[model samples]
Target: MSRSCPSRDAGLFPSEAEIARRLSQTPQEWAAKAKVLERDGLPRVDPLMGGRFWPAVRAYFLARYGLAGAEALAPDGPENLDAL
Candidate 1:
């Protein structure tokens, strides 16, 4: 069955702190996961922009929680990655 989407603002990705908060994890904990994400092909860090890709974060969310869980974490709701 389809799940309810999250309520998120348009054009804004969830910050690292926000993702951590939703997962009930400390920033440090999330950072550790980010490290793994980087190793798996997500950018290590955007030196100029100062954050990882939002899609990477969304993928991580999906890996950890599945579609419904990922949607729950996304304030702006899950995106249609297929459209990208």
Candidate 2:
């Protein structure tokens, strides 16, 4: 069953509906993705917000793909920076 977020949480964060909308998925599809990503670092839904924290998800993906949070230095120098 879909539970509605109380008024106090109405706009504090994205709800499952909003998240699913952004990903072009239905609530059912979002639920499936959430389950699959649970062990892959996707943030759990904060009951208070009725959804996962969007920034946390972004951070996870960024780090997963080595896009951010890597140590500073190109081990092989700037010329080979893209290879890392």
Candidate 3:
């Protein structure tokens, strides 16, 4: 068998507060997600992993909850990262 995807790994982490600021979410909400990630063994704050994580999270919410759900999380949408 052969694998074509890169191995999943993470990097140095930031505080939830820092992530909250970067993503523009309330610290309370960040803290809650952080807790869930911790409980579920999800990596939410690793700097390197975070780059991979946040985008995937954004796509998920956009697909599941729609842009309106991400309004607070990503007010700028594709413009957030200049994808637009």
Candidate 4:
């Protein structure tokens, strides 16, 4: 799950539970985006993250929560930006 940042603020990143919650909030939104992605016909799957489920799931998370309006959650080049 979540790992506390070593910084003074020691904020928490999304845990598996948090990620699940964020992902669960708006399945319709994710389905819509996934449709667009499917139309575009990109790889839509990243082998690095254990097959096809992760990309769509991660996309849903990013669209729903990993972004703040327009900026990414960790915009200084997120470690897993592409996944989301």
For 16-51, candidate 1 gives per-residue lDDT tens digits of 665556668887897787678677755455566444
Task: Compare candidates 3 and 4 on lDDT and give the better one.
Answer: 3
Across 1-84, the per-residue lDDT of candidate 3 in tens digits comes to 112122322222344454566668876887777676556544445554443355544454456454635444446534455555
TM-score of candidate 1 against the unseen true structure: 0.43
Off by over 4 Å in 1: 1-14, 60-84
Residue-level lDDT tens digits of model 2 in 16-73: 7766776688988988988998798789989865667877866776887888676577
TM-scores for every predicted model: 0.43, 0.58, 0.33, 0.25
Q: Encode model 4's per-residue lDDT on 1-84: one tens digit a residue.
A: 234223411223323333334557444564465567656542344445322354455555456564624643555653876787
Is 1 or 3 the stronger prediction by lDDT? Answer: 1
By summed lDDT, the worst window of 10 consecutive residues in model 1 runs over: 2-11
Q: What's the C-alpha lDDT at position 79 in model 4?
A: 80
Candidate maximizing lDDT: 2
Error of 4 at 20 (Å): 8.5
Report the alpha-carbon TM-score of model 2 versus the true structure: 0.58
